[model samples]
Target: MSSPIFTTPDEVEAAFYAALAHADLDRMMAIWSEDDEVVCVHPGSIRLIGLVAIRESWRQLFASGARITVSATHPVRWSNLMTAVHTVHQHVHVEGDDRLHPPIIATNVFARGALGWKMVMHHASPAPDMDNLHSNDSPHIIH
Candidate 1:
């Protein structure tokens, strides 16, 4: 795989969502680093490690009936020449209704490898309110 010249973190982020929107498993996997150390934690799920597990997990998710849309906000970024990290809040909206899904906080880590910027870690979890219950925010529509 050739290295992708990612000019901005937003570009990498956009590609990640675009891949999910299309349910293109290969394209989605391409964004990740080819290493066993890579990690992904879906909302309300246990941490998934390595490329194979991550790929299978996404495959299962994409195979589900519902279509998902993700809107991102409040991104915090850290980077060096070889790596970058982005922590963003995702407001997910499932199709068929206007109801809001629980908000997700994700820590996405990327490494500049032979294949350019590849995601190494994606740790996502549901946001807990001050009372310890899930947050009660309205779903945000992506424009």
Candidate 2:
């Protein structure tokens, strides 16, 4: 069966995580655009550009045979007619592990094409502690 056409960036993002949680390679790739400009940065790993590199990177990761539970929260988004940018706090729980991992900050970019909204870039990095994240709430000077 073929993948469903994602009509919105939200749909694409949802499918991306669902595929990841299941280690479904084909399904994950379906959410990404086929453009050579597409990019993905997996946490601390080097950036993967183009479909071939990205696919191979994911393929290697999925080979580990561990399921990852990804939950997206605290979303901040910006969109126009053709492009959209979404930033969210990503919480990951590895199946069978009890330790809590720090949240990750992720940015997903999507573009509209003939097929519909497809993700062009996904960049994720470790997020700072909540106190550090809120430290800049006001302008203060160190004595």
The runs of at least 3 residues in candidate 1 whose Cα sits more than 4 Å from the true structure, single-residue gaps closed, are 1-8, 131-143
Question: Clashes in model 2: which pairs?
Answer: none
Best by lDDT: 2
lDDT of 2 at 105: 98
lDDT of each: 0.81, 0.93
Give candidate 2's whole-model lDDT. 0.93
Query: Per-residue error at 113 for model 2, in Å?
Result: 0.4
Q: What's the CA error at residue 130 for candidate 1, in Å?
A: 3.8
